[model samples]
Target: MTRYWPRFNRAGFEESVAPIDYLEWYIPRLEELRAHNLSFSGMQYNWNVLDLLGDTIADIAKPYMGDVDDPKEIIAAREGVNIENVLITNGATQGINIALLTAIAKIRNKSNGKITVAVESPTYAPIPQSALILADDVIRVNRYPPKDYGHWRINYEEWSAALKKSDILMITPISNPSGWFFHKDDLAWIIDQAKISNVTIIADEAYNDAYREIDDYCSIHSVAPNSISINSLTKVYAMGHIRFGWIVSDSETIAIARRIFMTFSGVMSSPAMRIGTKVLQQSSIVDEAIADYRSKNLPKLRSVFAKHGIVWNEPLSGVFGCFELPNGIHSELFADHYCKVNDLLVVPGTMFSDSMQNWVRVAWSIDPKSFELAVDALDRSLELALNQKQVNKSK
Candidate 1:
């Protein structure tokens, strides 16, 4: 038998998926903990639905039962854009994937030599990971660690220079793992550079609404002609199970990306479409969900992170933040250590960026009671991690 590696930079994503989900395959050693609600690992805000709008489970149960309802109207209203500008996707990830593939197709058809995707470094892993998998070429621009929470901006000059060398820029508005969103002027600077370089900016705003209380985030779709915004119900709406998301942009990009989406599955599931549209039309439900999460969980998480000496930028608009763990502990190791010993599962920063190896992303979104329990367990876990480090050194 012959064997070949995938060549895509999916190894890190593959390795971390199972552990991050707290499944039994790799963490057989922590079977009991696996069953517990100790998750701080995932980015989704798990919340209770305030209403049951489903007419019947059977009606929307199968894909064929749901009518040909388009999410364009609802999304257009939500994003304040024209109906033709929105294309519904199965999820934000799929939206991102199709967008990338569309760009690849366009660039390849132009007979442009292999295109380069410039990803801001220390970003959501999948931005670069997916780019590398699709384009097989990526130019990374580094973002230095902020000494404190208030200063989370990256150098505009450095980022623009990297943008000049690429055909596509896959960036996150409110970063996953990090929770650090860009300032308004910095976002404008990026858009200006993209226009100058003729690079398509894929602005991922998955976590945009998480900080609505603090900063009213403006999507680049309103400001930049060359930018596309992909967002999902997975994060802020606390509706991850719906698998609903959409891309907002000009007609040309939507036409190409829509064709790519059709090639993938033709249409989204009936239940997903029905539920997704309903959710978007109803803003009160979404608002209440996030408000509940903030009121119930933020204070405890803030206390827990501070007490553990975990330094992180206060998330401007999301429930999770990339956290710098104290010295004498590594992300992958501490993530495992914290999970097994304290049932507090976290995703290590290595999953996001190579430079973030010592960091771990902790979510403020989780089952509120479980999140509280995880916070209670933090001190003991940090102490245990330190003690274990000492033992390893002695060996």
Candidate 2:
């Protein structure tokens, strides 16, 4: 008997599905820290926006029993895709999970070798972690460092090589830490490579909706028919409570994903789909608020970072970016110290990748005045941390 590498090995699942360390570190600081919550990577939810939904609380609650309208139809009409191509899920996380499950199922049948998944470094934790469980092997395709720090651009050679061996490439279209959207030519090149290799590109597009103004903005599934694009209201629309997201791909892929989804979740939440429909119709309100926040707060954020001698990627559209720490201080150490001493919150980049230990992710999605206070607090925290490091050296 020949020993071929097994697909979705039970022992592999045990080792691969560890806790998402970032969420573990972040949730405590997020709840306990009362002042200056810079860790808000999403637009701060505007409580009053619910009143503008054009539905009474009682009317919205009706869907808890079940929704009459098909969510796939709603999203298809909005995204200009066919109903067959859409699969509604609880959130972007579930969309990604379903996509991976589908990808592995599709690849394992065809491949003689172990299935490999390639993910970007400095990424949102779940992308790589989820990939680890579903694939036989997971490899990092660096998105930073080879390029200068803070600047994000994919190296074509590395990606092309990875695509040859990989069954799935999990990417964030607009990167989480750096907020860098792919260059048009680069994206096209990647699609071509995936097409040639028959590798699936599962794009986590949670932040893509934020930059509709950008001319190059189009869902990956639309361009690369075999690829999948997943999006949600969690980050860009400031509607995390709704738990609404969807996947766009070819009809066949969507069908496969739906089956996998049903195995895990018997049905989608009716209430979430109903509220999500209203929110989609009312998205302009959130977009306008985001624009207002950016206009009033971006300059202040830029000014404060410059004052503190901190350099950042300077995001093109979104309100967040990755910052390189001064004097090569460890980001995890500084983030913990910052929260404890100053009651502030910032995400340490170590959560994204071990290589990113010297970097931190910061967001200015709060109101202008509140953001101003947070940046000032950040400045003071930086000085104190630096001074403390110096004191330790003297001892």
Which prediction has the highest TM-score against the true structure? 2
Question: Number of clashes in every candidate structure?
Answer: 4, 0
Tell me the lDDT of model 1 at 212.
54
Q: What is the C-alpha RMSD of each candidate to the true structure, in Å?
A: 4.9, 5.1
Candidate 2, run of 10 with poorest lDDT: 1-10
Lowest-scoring 10 consecutive residues by lDDT in candidate 1?
1-10
User: Which pairs clash (backbone N, Cα, C closer than 3 Å) in model 2?
Assistant: none
Global lDDT scores for all candidate models: 0.69, 0.78
Report the number of the highest-lDDT candidate: 2
Candidate 1 per-residue lDDT, tens place, 59-142, comes to: 666664336356788778877888889988888888788888877777785536678888876665556767866774678776
Q: In lDDT terms, how accurate is model 1?
A: 0.69
